[model samples]
Target: MLNEEIPDVPYHVNGVEYERGYYLADGIYPTWASFVKGFSCAVDKKRSYFTRKQAGARKDIERTFGILQGRWHILQQPARGYEVNQMRRLMYTCIIIHNIIIEDIGYNLAENDWVVEPVVRMQRTWIDRCDTRKRRTKELRDSEVHEGLR
Candidate 1:
Protein backbone atom coordinates (compact mmCIF):
# COMPACT_ATOMS: atom_id res chain seq x y z
CA MET A 1 0.00 0.00 0.00
CA LEU A 2 3.02 2.28 0.16
CA ASN A 3 2.95 3.25 -3.50
CA GLU A 4 -0.84 3.05 -3.86
CA GLU A 5 -0.96 6.84 -3.98
CA ILE A 6 0.50 6.99 -7.50
CA PRO A 7 -0.03 5.26 -10.84
CA ASP A 8 3.76 5.16 -11.18
CA VAL A 9 6.18 5.86 -8.34
CA PRO A 10 9.58 7.35 -9.11
CA TYR A 11 12.83 6.62 -7.31
CA HIS A 12 12.59 9.94 -5.42
CA VAL A 13 10.06 11.72 -3.25
CA ASN A 14 9.49 14.45 -5.84
CA GLY A 15 8.28 11.82 -8.30
CA VAL A 16 4.63 10.86 -8.89
CA GLU A 17 3.23 13.72 -6.85
CA TYR A 18 -0.56 13.61 -6.76
CA GLU A 19 -2.78 16.42 -7.95
CA ARG A 20 -5.31 18.39 -5.86
CA GLY A 21 -8.20 15.99 -6.63
CA TYR A 22 -6.53 12.95 -5.09
CA TYR A 23 -5.59 14.98 -2.01
CA LEU A 24 -9.14 16.34 -1.64
CA ALA A 25 -10.79 12.94 -2.14
CA ASP A 26 -8.59 11.01 0.29
CA GLY A 27 -9.77 13.21 3.24
CA ILE A 28 -7.12 12.12 5.74
CA TYR A 29 -3.74 13.84 5.70
CA PRO A 30 -4.53 15.92 2.65
CA THR A 31 -1.08 16.59 1.18
CA TRP A 32 1.42 14.17 -0.37
CA ALA A 33 4.36 16.22 0.94
CA SER A 34 3.01 16.15 4.49
CA PHE A 35 1.96 12.50 4.24
CA VAL A 36 5.35 11.30 2.99
CA LYS A 37 7.24 13.53 5.42
CA GLY A 38 5.33 12.23 8.43
CA PHE A 39 6.15 8.65 7.54
CA SER A 40 9.75 9.63 6.88
CA CYS A 41 9.98 11.26 10.32
CA ALA A 42 8.61 8.08 11.80
CA VAL A 43 11.18 6.25 9.66
CA ASP A 44 14.05 8.44 10.97
CA LYS A 45 12.99 8.42 14.67
CA LYS A 46 13.11 12.23 14.79
CA ARG A 47 9.77 13.73 15.90
CA SER A 48 6.07 12.92 15.85
CA TYR A 49 6.64 9.51 17.41
CA PHE A 50 3.22 9.70 19.01
CA THR A 51 1.62 10.90 15.76
CA ARG A 52 2.96 7.91 13.88
CA LYS A 53 1.78 5.69 16.71
CA GLN A 54 -1.71 7.19 16.54
CA ALA A 55 -1.76 6.65 12.79
CA GLY A 56 -1.01 2.96 13.29
CA ALA A 57 -3.69 2.62 15.96
CA ARG A 58 -6.15 4.23 13.55
CA LYS A 59 -5.62 1.32 11.15
CA ASP A 60 -8.25 -0.57 13.13
CA ILE A 61 -10.88 1.73 11.62
CA GLU A 62 -9.76 0.58 8.18
CA ARG A 63 -9.93 -3.04 9.31
CA THR A 64 -13.41 -2.36 10.68
CA PHE A 65 -14.54 -1.02 7.30
CA GLY A 66 -13.06 -4.06 5.56
CA ILE A 67 -14.84 -6.35 8.01
CA LEU A 68 -18.16 -4.63 7.29
CA GLN A 69 -17.78 -5.30 3.55
CA GLY A 70 -16.73 -8.92 4.11
CA ARG A 71 -19.41 -9.73 6.70
CA TRP A 72 -22.37 -7.90 5.13
CA HIS A 73 -22.37 -8.16 1.36
CA ILE A 74 -25.65 -6.21 1.20
CA LEU A 75 -23.71 -2.93 1.31
CA GLN A 76 -22.66 -3.36 -2.33
CA GLN A 77 -26.19 -4.17 -3.59
CA PRO A 78 -28.93 -1.59 -4.21
CA ALA A 79 -31.85 -0.86 -1.89
CA ARG A 80 -34.86 -3.06 -2.69
CA GLY A 81 -37.37 -2.31 0.07
CA TYR A 82 -35.38 -0.72 2.87
CA GLU A 83 -35.30 3.06 3.20
CA VAL A 84 -31.85 4.65 2.71
CA ASN A 85 -32.11 6.52 6.01
CA GLN A 86 -33.01 3.32 7.87
CA MET A 87 -30.17 1.44 6.23
CA ARG A 88 -27.66 4.08 7.37
CA ARG A 89 -29.06 3.89 10.90
CA LEU A 90 -28.72 0.11 10.86
CA MET A 91 -25.12 0.37 9.69
CA TYR A 92 -24.27 2.87 12.42
CA THR A 93 -25.92 0.61 15.03
CA CYS A 94 -23.88 -2.35 13.80
CA ILE A 95 -20.70 -0.29 14.01
CA ILE A 96 -21.50 0.69 17.56
CA ILE A 97 -22.13 -2.95 18.48
CA HIS A 98 -18.88 -3.96 16.83
CA ASN A 99 -17.06 -1.33 18.87
CA ILE A 100 -18.60 -2.81 22.01
CA ILE A 101 -17.36 -6.25 21.08
CA ILE A 102 -13.92 -4.88 20.40
CA GLU A 103 -13.92 -3.15 23.77
CA ASP A 104 -15.05 -6.29 25.57
CA ILE A 105 -12.16 -8.21 24.06
CA GLY A 106 -9.58 -6.02 25.96
CA TYR A 107 -8.81 -3.95 22.85
CA ASN A 108 -8.99 -0.38 24.12
CA LEU A 109 -7.64 2.14 21.59
CA ALA A 110 -7.34 5.12 23.92
CA GLU A 111 -4.44 3.65 25.85
CA ASN A 112 -2.56 2.57 22.73
CA ASP A 113 -3.13 5.78 20.78
CA TRP A 114 -0.22 8.23 20.37
CA VAL A 115 -1.15 11.59 18.90
CA VAL A 116 1.55 13.38 16.89
CA GLU A 117 1.75 17.14 17.22
CA PRO A 118 1.02 19.44 14.30
CA VAL A 119 3.82 20.82 12.12
CA VAL A 120 3.61 24.45 13.25
CA ARG A 121 6.97 24.03 15.00
CA MET A 122 8.27 21.23 12.76
CA GLN A 123 8.82 23.40 9.65
CA ARG A 124 12.53 23.60 10.19
CA THR A 125 12.67 19.93 10.99
CA TRP A 126 10.81 19.20 7.75
CA ILE A 127 13.17 21.35 5.63
CA ASP A 128 16.24 19.78 7.24
CA ARG A 129 14.96 16.29 6.67
CA CYS A 130 13.99 17.05 3.10
CA ASP A 131 17.51 18.37 2.47
CA THR A 132 18.95 15.16 3.88
CA ARG A 133 16.60 13.19 1.67
CA LYS A 134 17.64 15.15 -1.41
CA ARG A 135 21.28 14.46 -0.67
CA ARG A 136 20.53 10.75 -0.30
CA THR A 137 18.94 10.69 -3.75
CA LYS A 138 22.42 10.01 -5.10
CA GLU A 139 22.01 6.38 -4.05
CA LEU A 140 19.34 5.94 -6.74
CA ARG A 141 21.89 6.66 -9.49
CA ASP A 142 23.27 3.16 -9.10
CA SER A 143 19.84 1.56 -9.40
CA GLU A 144 18.78 3.21 -12.68
CA VAL A 145 21.28 5.59 -14.21
CA HIS A 146 19.76 8.89 -15.27
CA GLU A 147 21.21 11.59 -17.53
CA GLY A 148 21.45 14.44 -15.00
CA LEU A 149 24.59 13.14 -13.27
CA ARG A 150 25.84 16.42 -11.93
Candidate 2:
Protein backbone atom coordinates (compact mmCIF):
# COMPACT_ATOMS: atom_id res chain seq x y z
CA MET A 1 0.00 0.00 0.00
CA LEU A 2 1.54 3.25 -1.16
CA ASN A 3 0.42 6.58 0.27
CA GLU A 4 -1.36 7.13 -3.02
CA GLU A 5 -3.03 3.73 -2.96
CA ILE A 6 -5.97 5.08 -1.11
CA PRO A 7 -9.04 6.46 -1.52
CA ASP A 8 -7.86 3.02 -2.69
CA VAL A 9 -11.21 1.69 -3.82
CA PRO A 10 -11.82 -1.87 -4.98
CA TYR A 11 -8.91 -3.93 -6.22
CA HIS A 12 -8.34 -7.47 -7.41
CA VAL A 13 -6.72 -10.25 -5.47
CA ASN A 14 -6.24 -13.35 -7.65
CA GLY A 15 -8.73 -11.71 -10.07
CA VAL A 16 -11.19 -11.64 -7.15
CA GLU A 17 -12.15 -8.07 -6.57
CA TYR A 18 -12.60 -6.56 -3.11
CA GLU A 19 -12.42 -3.18 -1.41
CA ARG A 20 -8.90 -2.10 -0.63
CA GLY A 21 -8.12 0.09 2.35
CA TYR A 22 -5.19 2.17 3.61
CA TYR A 23 -3.08 1.35 6.64
CA LEU A 24 -1.49 4.18 8.56
CA ALA A 25 2.18 4.00 9.19
CA ASP A 26 3.66 4.90 12.64
CA GLY A 27 0.57 5.88 14.66
CA ILE A 28 -0.85 8.43 12.24
CA TYR A 29 -3.46 8.62 9.47
CA PRO A 30 -6.90 7.05 9.24
CA THR A 31 -6.86 3.32 8.64
CA TRP A 32 -9.46 0.78 7.77
CA ALA A 33 -10.73 -2.03 10.03
CA SER A 34 -10.75 -1.60 13.74
CA PHE A 35 -7.53 -2.83 15.31
CA VAL A 36 -9.42 -5.33 17.37
CA LYS A 37 -10.52 -8.67 16.01
CA GLY A 38 -11.95 -9.10 12.51
CA PHE A 39 -9.84 -6.40 10.89
CA SER A 40 -10.77 -7.58 7.44
CA CYS A 41 -13.75 -8.14 5.19
CA ALA A 42 -12.49 -11.31 3.55
CA VAL A 43 -14.18 -14.66 3.88
CA ASP A 44 -12.89 -16.55 6.84
CA LYS A 45 -10.98 -19.70 6.01
CA LYS A 46 -10.94 -22.30 8.74
CA ARG A 47 -8.05 -24.32 7.48
CA SER A 48 -4.75 -24.35 9.36
CA TYR A 49 -2.72 -24.00 6.20
CA PHE A 50 -4.75 -21.04 5.09
CA THR A 51 -4.50 -19.48 8.50
CA ARG A 52 -0.74 -19.94 8.62
CA LYS A 53 -0.27 -18.56 5.16
CA GLN A 54 -2.48 -15.59 5.87
CA ALA A 55 -0.91 -14.95 9.22
CA GLY A 56 2.49 -15.34 7.72
CA ALA A 57 1.70 -12.95 4.92
CA ARG A 58 0.15 -10.35 7.18
CA LYS A 59 2.85 -10.92 9.80
CA ASP A 60 1.49 -8.22 12.12
CA ILE A 61 0.39 -10.90 14.51
CA GLU A 62 3.94 -12.13 14.79
CA ARG A 63 5.36 -8.63 15.13
CA THR A 64 2.79 -7.66 17.75
CA PHE A 65 3.45 -10.80 19.68
CA GLY A 66 7.14 -10.14 19.47
CA ILE A 67 6.72 -6.62 20.81
CA LEU A 68 4.40 -7.66 23.62
CA GLN A 69 6.57 -10.57 24.53
CA GLY A 70 9.64 -8.36 24.64
CA ARG A 71 8.14 -6.23 27.34
CA TRP A 72 7.90 -8.35 30.47
CA HIS A 73 5.23 -6.06 31.95
CA ILE A 74 3.10 -6.20 28.83
CA LEU A 75 3.91 -9.83 28.32
CA GLN A 76 3.16 -10.79 31.92
CA GLN A 77 0.27 -8.54 32.86
CA PRO A 78 -1.00 -6.51 29.95
CA ALA A 79 -4.31 -5.46 31.43
CA ARG A 80 -4.50 -6.93 34.87
CA GLY A 81 -5.05 -3.67 36.73
CA TYR A 82 -6.54 -1.54 34.01
CA GLU A 83 -10.09 -0.29 33.56
CA VAL A 84 -12.00 -1.27 30.43
CA ASN A 85 -10.99 1.97 28.76
CA GLN A 86 -7.49 1.83 30.15
CA MET A 87 -7.09 -1.72 28.98
CA ARG A 88 -8.12 -0.67 25.53
CA ARG A 89 -5.62 2.13 25.76
CA LEU A 90 -2.88 -0.17 26.86
CA MET A 91 -3.53 -2.69 24.10
CA TYR A 92 -3.47 -0.08 21.36
CA THR A 93 -0.53 1.86 22.66
CA CYS A 94 1.29 -1.39 22.79
CA ILE A 95 0.15 -2.05 19.25
CA ILE A 96 1.37 1.32 17.96
CA ILE A 97 4.58 0.96 19.82
CA HIS A 98 4.88 -2.48 18.36
CA ASN A 99 4.14 -1.34 14.83
CA ILE A 100 6.65 1.48 14.78
CA ILE A 101 9.41 -0.85 15.68
CA ILE A 102 8.42 -3.19 12.91
CA GLU A 103 8.29 -0.46 10.29
CA ASP A 104 11.71 0.84 11.22
CA ILE A 105 13.45 -2.43 10.47
CA GLY A 106 10.97 -4.70 8.71
CA TYR A 107 12.12 -4.29 5.12
CA ASN A 108 15.61 -5.68 5.57
CA LEU A 109 14.20 -8.76 7.22
CA ALA A 110 10.45 -9.18 6.82
CA GLU A 111 8.17 -8.86 3.82
CA ASN A 112 5.73 -6.09 4.79
CA ASP A 113 4.80 -3.62 7.49
CA TRP A 114 1.56 -4.70 9.17
CA VAL A 115 1.16 -2.49 12.21
CA VAL A 116 -0.38 0.79 11.14
CA GLU A 117 -0.12 3.55 13.79
CA PRO A 118 -3.53 5.16 13.27
CA VAL A 119 -5.11 1.80 13.74
CA VAL A 120 -2.79 1.22 16.68
CA ARG A 121 -3.51 4.65 18.17
CA MET A 122 -7.21 4.35 17.43
CA GLN A 123 -7.26 1.16 19.42
CA ARG A 124 -5.12 2.84 22.06
CA THR A 125 -7.16 6.03 22.24
CA TRP A 126 -10.46 4.26 22.11
CA ILE A 127 -9.16 1.98 24.75
CA ASP A 128 -6.88 5.01 26.33
CA ARG A 129 -2.20 4.21 25.98
CA CYS A 130 1.15 3.78 23.29
CA ASP A 131 4.12 1.37 23.44
CA THR A 132 6.10 3.39 20.98
CA ARG A 133 9.13 2.54 23.04
CA LYS A 134 8.37 -1.11 23.49
CA ARG A 135 7.63 -1.58 19.82
CA ARG A 136 10.91 0.15 18.96
CA THR A 137 12.77 -2.23 21.19
CA LYS A 138 11.13 -5.16 19.49
CA GLU A 139 12.23 -3.79 16.14
CA LEU A 140 15.82 -3.71 17.32
CA ARG A 141 15.55 -7.20 18.69
CA ASP A 142 14.09 -8.38 15.44
CA SER A 143 17.00 -6.87 13.61
CA GLU A 144 19.34 -8.76 15.89
CA VAL A 145 17.33 -11.90 15.38
CA HIS A 146 17.60 -11.39 11.68
CA GLU A 147 21.32 -11.30 12.22
CA GLY A 148 20.98 -14.75 13.87
CA LEU A 149 20.04 -13.92 17.43
CA ARG A 150 17.87 -17.00 17.24
Candidate 3:
Protein backbone atom coordinates (compact mmCIF):
# COMPACT_ATOMS: atom_id res chain seq x y z
CA MET A 1 0.00 0.00 0.00
CA LEU A 2 1.12 3.58 -0.65
CA ASN A 3 1.27 6.31 1.97
CA GLU A 4 -0.79 8.52 -0.44
CA GLU A 5 2.07 11.04 -0.50
CA ILE A 6 2.43 12.89 -3.77
CA PRO A 7 5.98 13.47 -5.01
CA ASP A 8 6.82 16.94 -6.33
CA VAL A 9 7.56 15.52 -9.76
CA PRO A 10 6.00 16.72 -13.02
CA TYR A 11 4.49 14.19 -15.43
CA HIS A 12 2.98 14.42 -18.91
CA VAL A 13 -0.46 13.20 -20.03
CA ASN A 14 -1.56 13.72 -23.66
CA GLY A 15 0.99 16.57 -24.11
CA VAL A 16 -0.19 18.18 -20.87
CA GLU A 17 2.05 18.51 -17.83
CA TYR A 18 0.69 17.58 -14.39
CA GLU A 19 2.64 18.13 -11.18
CA ARG A 20 1.04 15.34 -9.14
CA GLY A 21 0.25 11.69 -9.68
CA TYR A 22 -3.41 10.63 -9.71
CA TYR A 23 -5.27 7.60 -8.40
CA LEU A 24 -8.21 5.77 -9.99
CA ALA A 25 -11.06 6.15 -7.54
CA ASP A 26 -14.86 5.84 -7.35
CA GLY A 27 -17.38 8.70 -7.14
CA ILE A 28 -17.26 8.48 -3.33
CA TYR A 29 -13.75 10.03 -3.31
CA PRO A 30 -13.29 13.79 -3.09
CA THR A 31 -13.03 15.95 -6.21
CA TRP A 32 -9.26 16.37 -5.95
CA ALA A 33 -6.81 16.43 -8.85
CA SER A 34 -5.15 13.35 -7.39
CA PHE A 35 -8.28 11.26 -7.80
CA VAL A 36 -9.30 10.36 -11.37
CA LYS A 37 -12.89 9.17 -11.16
CA GLY A 38 -15.23 7.95 -13.87
CA PHE A 39 -18.71 9.32 -14.42
CA SER A 40 -21.42 7.85 -12.24
CA CYS A 41 -24.35 8.28 -14.66
CA ALA A 42 -22.41 8.59 -17.98
CA VAL A 43 -25.15 10.19 -20.09
CA ASP A 44 -22.92 10.85 -23.13
CA LYS A 45 -21.17 8.32 -25.39
CA LYS A 46 -17.66 9.47 -24.43
CA ARG A 47 -18.51 9.42 -20.74
CA SER A 48 -20.05 5.96 -21.00
CA TYR A 49 -16.99 4.65 -22.82
CA PHE A 50 -14.67 6.22 -20.27
CA THR A 51 -16.72 4.83 -17.39
CA ARG A 52 -16.63 1.32 -18.86
CA LYS A 53 -12.88 1.42 -19.44
CA GLN A 54 -12.15 2.89 -16.02
CA ALA A 55 -14.43 0.39 -14.27
CA GLY A 56 -12.87 -2.51 -16.19
CA ALA A 57 -9.36 -1.41 -15.28
CA ARG A 58 -10.32 -1.03 -11.62
CA LYS A 59 -11.93 -4.47 -11.64
CA ASP A 60 -8.81 -6.01 -13.20
CA ILE A 61 -6.66 -4.52 -10.45
CA GLU A 62 -9.07 -5.73 -7.77
CA ARG A 63 -9.17 -9.25 -9.23
CA THR A 64 -5.38 -9.44 -9.44
CA PHE A 65 -4.97 -8.39 -5.81
CA GLY A 66 -7.81 -10.69 -4.76
CA ILE A 67 -6.02 -13.63 -6.33
CA LEU A 68 -2.76 -12.64 -4.66
CA GLN A 69 -4.45 -12.32 -1.29
CA GLY A 70 -6.22 -15.66 -1.72
CA ARG A 71 -2.95 -17.37 -2.58
CA TRP A 72 -0.85 -15.63 0.08
CA HIS A 73 -2.91 -15.13 3.23
CA ILE A 74 -0.17 -12.88 4.65
CA LEU A 75 -1.03 -10.28 2.01
CA GLN A 76 -4.69 -10.37 3.11
CA GLN A 77 -3.85 -9.02 6.58
CA PRO A 78 -2.57 -5.59 7.55
CA ALA A 79 1.19 -5.17 7.29
CA ARG A 80 1.52 -3.25 10.55
CA GLY A 81 4.18 -5.37 12.26
CA TYR A 82 6.42 -5.60 9.18
CA GLU A 83 8.96 -2.96 8.17
CA VAL A 84 8.79 -1.30 4.74
CA ASN A 85 11.62 -3.41 3.35
CA GLN A 86 10.10 -6.59 4.75
CA MET A 87 6.72 -5.74 3.25
CA ARG A 88 8.34 -5.09 -0.12
CA ARG A 89 10.16 -8.41 -0.06
CA LEU A 90 7.03 -10.25 1.01
CA MET A 91 4.98 -8.70 -1.79
CA TYR A 92 7.68 -9.38 -4.38
CA THR A 93 8.01 -12.99 -3.26
CA CYS A 94 4.26 -13.52 -3.49
CA ILE A 95 4.14 -11.97 -6.96
CA ILE A 96 7.04 -14.14 -8.14
CA ILE A 97 5.41 -17.26 -6.78
CA HIS A 98 2.11 -16.26 -8.36
CA ASN A 99 3.84 -15.76 -11.70
CA ILE A 100 5.44 -19.19 -11.41
CA ILE A 101 2.10 -20.79 -10.69
CA ILE A 102 0.53 -19.02 -13.62
CA GLU A 103 3.32 -20.27 -15.86
CA ASP A 104 2.90 -23.79 -14.58
CA ILE A 105 -0.81 -23.60 -15.35
CA GLY A 106 0.04 -22.29 -18.86
CA TYR A 107 -1.87 -19.09 -18.36
CA ASN A 108 -1.15 -16.35 -20.90
CA LEU A 109 2.32 -17.68 -21.59
CA ALA A 110 2.68 -15.77 -24.85
CA GLU A 111 1.55 -12.44 -23.48
CA ASN A 112 3.14 -12.73 -20.04
CA ASP A 113 6.54 -14.20 -20.82
CA TRP A 114 9.11 -13.69 -18.09
CA VAL A 115 11.68 -11.10 -19.10
CA VAL A 116 14.67 -10.74 -16.79
CA GLU A 117 16.10 -7.26 -16.85
CA PRO A 118 18.73 -5.58 -14.71
CA VAL A 119 17.23 -3.34 -12.02
CA VAL A 120 18.48 0.23 -12.06
CA ARG A 121 18.15 2.24 -8.87
CA MET A 122 18.11 6.02 -9.01
CA GLN A 123 19.12 8.31 -6.14
CA ARG A 124 17.01 11.41 -5.39
CA THR A 125 18.51 14.56 -3.92
CA TRP A 126 16.11 17.00 -2.22
CA ILE A 127 17.15 20.51 -1.21
CA ASP A 128 14.06 21.34 0.90
CA ARG A 129 11.65 18.48 1.36
CA CYS A 130 9.11 20.59 3.27
CA ASP A 131 8.96 23.29 0.60
CA THR A 132 8.59 20.67 -2.12
CA ARG A 133 5.77 19.02 -0.17
CA LYS A 134 3.89 22.34 0.23
CA ARG A 135 4.08 22.93 -3.52
CA ARG A 136 3.07 19.35 -4.27
CA THR A 137 0.01 19.65 -2.02
CA LYS A 138 -1.23 22.71 -3.95
CA GLU A 139 -0.62 20.99 -7.29
CA LEU A 140 -2.43 17.87 -6.13
CA ARG A 141 -5.51 19.85 -5.14
CA ASP A 142 -5.70 21.84 -8.39
CA SER A 143 -9.36 21.70 -9.49
CA GLU A 144 -8.48 22.94 -12.98
CA VAL A 145 -6.33 19.90 -13.67
CA HIS A 146 -8.99 17.68 -12.13
CA GLU A 147 -11.68 19.04 -14.49
CA GLY A 148 -9.31 18.81 -17.45
CA LEU A 149 -8.64 15.16 -16.65
CA ARG A 150 -12.35 14.49 -16.34
Tell me each candidate's TM-score.
Answer: 0.33, 0.33, 0.64
For residue 111, what is the lDDT in candidate 2? Answer: 58
Candidate no. 1 TM-score: 0.33
Give me the overall lDDT of model 3.
0.73
For residues 10-55, write the lDDT of model 3, one tens digit per residue: 6787688865567888888888798888988889999899889988
Give candidate 2's error at residue 84 in angstroms: 0.9
Residues 25-143 of candidate 1 have per-residue lDDT tens digits of 12244333322212333444534574465456556656676677677653555556679787978677667767777899988866775454442423457677677566544332222
Backbone clash pairs in model 2 (N, Cα, C under 3 Å; residues 3+ apart or in different chains), count: 10
> Comparing 1 and 3 by lDDT, which wins?
3
Instruction: Name the better of 2 and 3 by lDDT.
Output: 3
Candidate 3's clash total is: 0
- Give the whole-model CA lDDT for all candidates, comma-separated: 0.46, 0.44, 0.73
Clashes of each: 1, 10, 0
lDDT, candidate 3, at 26: 88
lDDT of 2 by residue, 1-150 (tens): 222222334554345544433222222322323111222333555333444554454576666667577873574664566788887777777867765775787533245434333422233442222354454344333422221210
Scanning candidate 2 in windows of ten residues, the lowest lDDT window is: 29-38
Q: So what's the TM-score on candidate 2?
A: 0.33
Question: Whose TM-score is higher: candidate 2's or candidate 3's?
Answer: 3
